[model samples]
Target: MAEKKFRSGFVAIIGRPNVGKSSIMNKLVGEKVAIVSNKPQTTRTKIMGVVNGEDWQIVFLDTPGLHKPRTKLGEYMMKQASEAREGVDAVLCVVDGQHIGPGDRAVMEDVARMNCPKFLAVNKVDVTTPEGLMPQLQQLATIGFDEIVAVSALRGDNMDKLKDLLSGAMPEGPKYFPDDMITDQPERLICAEIIREKALLNLREEIPHGVGVEMLAITKLSDKLTEIHANVYCERASHKSIIIGKQGAMLQRIGSQARYDIERLLDTKVLLKLWVKVREDWRNRTGDLRAQGYED
Candidate 1:
């Protein structure tokens, strides 16, 4: 008798800003495929994380948080989140457990309008009580979700159960990617994101929403070491100074931290070179937006 083949499909995780959607994606994939920060709108693109199981493979997409757009870039990010729902096996609409506000309701309404197999994932359950969870889940359920799962993306609570549920919902199909692969993102893109995340962490509120990291050069120096040169582009000279810092100290710190994380992710030593440049309000410029990989 022949052995049985398994199934695989795509699952999109959507939610409002700072709602732990990226955290849940990282936890689900067992790796940091998406960057996590306390700041809102940190994730600005669609990232693919592959979860391999004994009998199934799930290609999970971590999208930018949905919100009311105030700029072209914000609108693009929202569009990316909306587009993820078009042709996926399942939609995991993540919401904060502690607070069920209008933002969560707006995203739930958008998911309902998709008319797909949707599930509600209440994240940050580690911070919520059983009593609080009940009301939140009940409120979200009324918005028309097919299933509900409570999970703590930070603590890994109920993540396995969530995976099982997602895998069960996938249609019978061959694996989209190999089991050894964890993500479909390019190494340069990942490196750029790592640098950007480090900036986001270090700069905090000093930087604006138009910052982007461009990998200018990457070269293998030896079997264990690589040389990388990247430029951080901002909308103004003042923002550039903020990123570069006094006596270039801030940029050095950002580069060191980012290089350490990149080395761990790539499993090799890296020499990171960082530069800050002003693009003069690049967020609204078509050419600049395309260069930053945000062009839709």
Candidate 2:
């Protein structure tokens, strides 16, 4: 009997802010490759998540949520999001199933111009009833998506089916990533993102987008323990105070939450040290943006 041929390709996951694109990518990869938060525009760069199947490998690019740019950092993020679809084998355009608004249409319109196979994914089905989703589904059906699947990425609903659909879309090619490899992101970058995600979860709504976490150092203190130092930058002194809290309570909470996930990620105990700093208007300054690792 002949053996099955290997297949591999890239899939760009694009959607507007807070549409669960990162959640879906994390679910599909079966690991947290991208940082996720409820706040809009949480992702500031293009993160790569790899899924290895029996005979196929799918490389997924989890990009920043597409939105109008207001600052230099925002412009960089938008560029990263838009360029992700170029030369990809497929494009998975995600949207919120509960709310199909003009933002959804704008993203789909851009996807419509792509040359690759376009797949539409309606997420958040777990929160929406069949009746509630019907109108949205009907409206989406009119679009020219090669395939459409409604899923709840958080609950793992229909994820396996979605994986199969994505795997089937790949072309016969070499295995792009090794079986054990799940992402292209460096450990330092992932750790920084992890810290940033924790901060986003703990901070107030207005504070997340302006927050940036930079990994200063990761030193192996022993075989069982590692030490990590990070700086959390905000746009104002008041935001810095809020992040640190009175008597350092808020900073402690952020570090405590981040260390748990970091330990799981690195497979060793971590001593995470966090410091709050104010880089006023860093988002609008190109040099500061690059210093914060926002370069394309």
Candidate 3:
């Protein structure tokens, strides 16, 4: 029998804010490498997740949601999304199946100019019927796509099919990542993201987007215990108060929720200590964005 050639390449997943780009990438990679939230712009940078098949490896770049930049942090995020599309084997543009709006159109148009094979994933199909998806499909038909698949990132519907299409798009090449490895994100960054995800889930609407988590220190206290100190940066003192909550209750809630996920991710007990600090318009400040790991 002839030997099989290994295939591997990068695929950038880009879409408008709150379009479930992270959710789709997580499902495709079969792991939660990026954080998810109901809020727009939950992801602040390009997160890479690697999927290894028997003879193929797919490197998925989960980029931040494409949106207008209002601050330096937003600009960095937009730049990350743009840079992720360059030098890739394919581009996977995800969009909401239920509501195909102008923002989605804008994203599709920008991606249309890219010089690579493009795949459109109409996500959240579980919530809508085939009939309900018609308008979205019709709208998407105007754009050029190599393949379009309807999927529910949360329900894993048609995920295997989507995976196959993505893997098939790869040219025969080297395995970019090992079989056991899933993501390229560092432990500190992942830890910080987990904390941020928890905060986004629990905090008020206006508070989550302005929030940034910085890993002050991460220490291996013992073989079974890891100590993580993080600072949750908000733009104003009032926002800090809201994050901390009455009698430090809200902060405690975010810490407890984050510690659970961190422990699972690290496979060790974690002592996550979080402190809420006000940086006064940190999102617009270049130094603050750099401090929060948003620098590009």
Candidate 2 clash pair list? none
> If scored against the real structure, what TM-score would every candidate get?
0.94, 0.97, 0.97
Model 3 TM: 0.97
Clashing pairs in 1: none
All predictions: root-mean-square deviation over Cα? 1.6, 1.1, 1.2
**Candidate lDDT values, in order:** 0.86, 0.89, 0.90
Supply the global lDDT for candidate 3: 0.90
Residue 184's lDDT in candidate 2: 80
Model 1 misplaced regions, further than 4 Å: 2-5, 206-208
In candidate 1, where is summed lDDT lowest over 10 consecutive residues?
Answer: 202-211
* Candidate 2 accuracy as TM-score: 0.97
Q: How many clashes (backbone atoms < 3 Å, residues ≥3 apart in a chain or on different chains) does model 3 have? A: 0
How many steric overlaps are in each model, in order? 0, 0, 0
Off by over 4 Å in 2: none
What C-alpha lDDT, on a 0 to 100 scale, does residue 205 get in candidate 3?
67
Which of candidates 2 and 3 reaches a greater lDDT? 3
